[model samples]
Target: MIKVVKRKGKYLVRQGHTRFHGLKLAISEGANIPKLSVILIDYKNEIEEYLENLDGNRSNGLNPVGQAHALAHAVSLGYSVEELAMRYQRSTTAIRNMLKILDMPLELQRLISLNLIKKTLAIEIMLKYSNDHKMVLKHIEGFLPGVKNIETTTSKIVGIPEHNAAGAGPDTLNKGGPEKKNSAVTRKTLGIKRLSHKKTERLKSEFLELVESTHTESITNTQTELKFGRDSAHLFKNVNSNNVIFSNDGVQIILNDEKLNILLSLLNDENTAIIVSKPKLEELLEIRDLLKEY
Candidate 1:
């Protein structure tokens, strides 16, 4: 798909590959060439250009995991939350929330991909427990041990303070005696308040049990499978996790961690060092000698 922007009197390509060979082939063969559709995009600046690029390709199998990587890369490359929000067609709050989700474990990513867990619920759990995986897992499994109270969990997401006027007096109020305590109690008990602890725990326990029993094993297995695949690829094919390239001679060059460490070690040593074989050492010394002469 080609995207174009107006420049002067003509439409100029803003994104997409300009493959001329296919058109040439069609023209030469006198085939009835199909008309290609072009999309016109309007961008105020470079930020918009980056957004357009992300959005245009995003719909093509860009799952939550893929989006996490892409968005993280954009962030590392200095795109601010506002710019990312505008580009991704999301609110700034959503962008921030999504960025937080990037730190999710592989198992959670698997669950997200399978649509087994709702993004909102995951975010709530993460926020409530400060992204402690153990707490998140235990809470999901219907075991709210220790301080993992439903009241605290709901309060954070629902925008209610843990200890309000009735529980803990407002900061501006002076420390006082029974009169202030009575007023606070009266205010708390007067109207409809949070559910009783028993009812809340019962409902939460049921909900968590249902969610965990349904999804946990599958997601955990998926995480294990993903890890195995990556490790196997590196071991058998010499295809590292990142920065792998195939040269024209059909050789794969991977600037992976092991290779990088070796290279750095060789560079740090002033004298010729043994690396791989004697010829390799001679080649390095030759390069060093050439650099010295220059």
Candidate 2:
């Protein structure tokens, strides 16, 4: 005979229904309905409290365990998957994937729990190295222990530019190249033991003399009264022969040491110049003499 019993909101079969029915038909026997106890437990509240406690204990409070428990609670609390995802700053797909990690190995789960691996890297490892998970774990164990010295390691791995390695650029390279070659040639030609200060001064003097002799005629013409302004009788101002006048065409004579030094400095720099004021022609001539001595 079959008998049906209801206990704690669940049904249980105690005996065969057919046999119970036959026995009741033959004897007119009455069947007893067992008392059912409804013991109410706040399961939802208990689950929520457990999840919240787990979340508080997790590294970054965003690990898989905490996330799964929270998500499950959210679902039980009548939140849609999309709504739960939005609340947790994740995509629905990511939430689903997090749920999937619940089936991964315990070591990997512990790695996630301890924050040894970030979520993104952990996801990458799982996707690429799942077949060789042991090897991947070994790599992480061996390599990821210390702080990385990125700058030094990168410099060593990738070399610096040859010229820039010594803190020089194109301008320095260009200027230094000729002088470097010339110094070697000069030492060979003159049989100099070393480049002494006296010898350097002498070479500079000779170079200056050569420059002056080459421009002698031009300097002489600068002394004459040249035309200034419109067609006139006496607008011919005397060229400041002592002052050095540097123009796009050639040098003009003014003759001050300071002004000559300024012009030479500008010329050495290969920079453009602007005329501030007119200079004395006599002072500039004296500078020409001084420059010749270097």
Candidate 3:
């Protein structure tokens, strides 16, 4: 029986001193020799489970599955796939795709496990250019954080930036004002405005539908009230209510005494308009008319 024992930060057999001494001498001469551990596990079932776990399931002993799993695991643990694959004799493409699973934000991975995203699509996204991949991942993370399968996630990610995806000139697409004017002129010359209004209306309908489809709870609301009351005087009072009072502005004001004072100070400013409910469409149209007049 080989007696396994620990000595000088290494595991060695007591009967194999000659071999151990040779290894120690090699280490002393600056050769890199790995330290070893000798564990005497008593549970047969536990040992079998461990053996099964370590088994690569390779028929021809190439162990591609084991290598792939190892590459994936190493990437998840923060080891760069390029470095590990270089050392382990695996293709960089395989390593990279494996690492992409690790690159998925934790929240997205949970969705993926739940079948929200397809595996093929996720792998495709992982293989995209770094910047494009990151942008797609960010959009997905924001909108469909709990998405599980690949198809849905891919569709959502691609759709978010579809406008930018058109190989149209970047300046024409992104730059506003004068550049947009030039582009419009060019479009008119090329007779590209054939379905312009129809396209605009379609986009408008799509935007409205998208907004309507979203959960209302995701939207936030803020209310502001303006009172036209005199100093220390109760403005408008409701007939049926005692504590609840109305303001002369035809709205209920629910401000503390201090806030009321600040609001009064702002009300006195000539340049300010008390905008209510995001400025009505009529008000916007009037502004446009005034601009046209100018």
Maximum-lDDT candidate: 1
After superposition, the stretches of candidate 1 with alpha carbons farther than 4 Å from their true spots are 4-30, 34-50, 58-61, 141-294
- Measured by TM-score, the strongest candidate is 1
- lDDT digits (tens) for residues 1-294 of candidate 3: 223334356643423334556777998999987873334323233223222222322221212222333455444445575766675576565555444554554434433343345444554343333325466556554554423333333333221111112111011111111111111112233233446777866865664554343213312243345444445244453234333355443535555454445566677856342333333433333323322332
lDDT of 1 by residue, 125-227 (tens): 5555656887766655442122222221121122111222222111121111122111111113323256788986786666455433322222221211112
User: Candidate 3, overall lDDT?
Assistant: 0.40
For each candidate in turn, the TM-score is 0.36, 0.25, 0.23
- Candidate that beats the other on lDDT, 2 or 3, i.e. the better one: 2
Question: How many residue-pair clashes does candidate 1 contain?
Answer: 0
lDDT of each: 0.47, 0.42, 0.40
Using TM-score as the yardstick, the better of models 1 and 2 is: 1
Instruction: Report how far off residue 108 is in candidate 1 (Å).
Output: 1.2
lDDT, residue 94, model 3: 51
Per-prediction count of colliding residue pairs?
0, 23, 11
Clashing pairs in 1: none
